[model samples]
Target: MAKDRYAPKTLDDLMANMSSRMSSYVGKSQQLNQHQELLTQCVGATMAQKCRISNYRDSILVIEAESAAVAMRLNYMKMSILSDLRKNGLADLCQIKIQTSPRAAADQQAQKKRSEPIHNSRILSQQTADALLEVAEHAPASLKTKLEKLAALSKKNK
Candidate 1:
């Protein structure tokens, strides 16, 4: 045979056969990129030396900052970032993940574990007191007193 003109020959022709699906994919990609930019702005609130957007795919924005300190600082601002993402209506297609390459996400997970309440109690118990001690160990001065009182109150309630 000399040629089969009807055979699928090019990417454009292949896409032409499925324009509806391709258009939706393109639209979603565009929406995701726009939301990623908006969430990227929240990075500046943390005093990050430089915030760069390395990738915006699958609704996850991977950010690279100039330093670990900056990344660590940004960690405390995650909820604010997430709120901004939601307030601006970008939450539907966007999420923020702070990436400091030297420290793995494991570090973040550990930090989160440290930050969150290790135990849930209707009323605080001795175990909760230990959790309070754990929190007080690293709590900032401004928060220490309030947290202490909370721990005390929870303990008394136990």
Candidate 2:
């Protein structure tokens, strides 16, 4: 009888095999990093909570403010923000643009093209689908993140 060559007979052997397959991705270029940072900072600005960053390019960043007031303020403050980003080395590779309307309107339209059942995506991952169904059995409205809280509250009442 031949020995099972594929099986890891011990935990250390399994860990060693996994470690041999590992690789690193530590460094990124300054230009790409700067553009990403610019996008992030623009999204973190005061007006950004009511806004969304949805368009980016090698030299442009476009955002959509949720309100007219925010849009106006962002437009007025654009140059200052751009200067700040340049000073911080972000705008060196990225320019800023603020729009009052949604940049993701096209994305919303694409999503509208999706007319399949809501559960179509759920079925894509069988494990997640089963988990969601199992959770639904307990409380249809209870979210997974809220499960522990609900259980704790129930225990306290008992």
Candidate 3:
């Protein structure tokens, strides 16, 4: 049996064998994440939750704020944020760009909606229940049972 030089022994070895471009992209992603953390710390918890570092390229940091209000606030504090980022090792940092992203706020709202418990508060009225019972009387045995069960819900509701 011949040993395969290209065969990776473990996940770490496989990752280590990744192309230079992929490695560079991963490094850049990690660096951006670190910058995001530093930015959040500089902005404070309240404002940090409303905005995020979207990109860092050409010495310009792009910040995506959830709303216009947040964007305006970030715009007002841009110079301070730039200085803070510079102090935190982004010495080449030149400008801070703030963009209002309604989509981000919409996404958060959708997530909140998904997390909330759905409430079905609809109740069968007595008149509707009576109509169902009347129909159930002439219905086939199988359908009659289901209609009766549905009509019974009104009594339970009352």
lDDT of 2 by residue, 1-158 (tens): 99888866798877787766552212223444555456457536444455665555676767677567878877887787777667666544367787776545555556667964555231224444455556756774547546544444433443
lDDT per residue as tens, model 3, 80-123: 99899899889999988899998987887899999999998999
Local distance difference test, each candidate: 0.68, 0.59, 0.91
Q: Against the correct fold, how does model 1 do in TM-score?
A: 0.38
Candidate 1 ranges with C-alpha deviation above 4 Å: 1-29, 40-49, 54-61, 93-95, 101-158
State how far residue 96 of model 2 sits from its true place (Å). Answer: 2.3
Residue pairs with backbone overlap in model 1: none
lDDT ranking, best first: 3, 1, 2
> For candidate 1, lDDT tens digit of each residue in 62-114?
66655687677767877787688677775553677877664444565577799
**Candidate 2 vs candidate 3, lDDT winner:** 3
Best by TM-score: 3
TM-score of 3: 0.58
Alpha-carbon lDDT of model 3 = 0.91
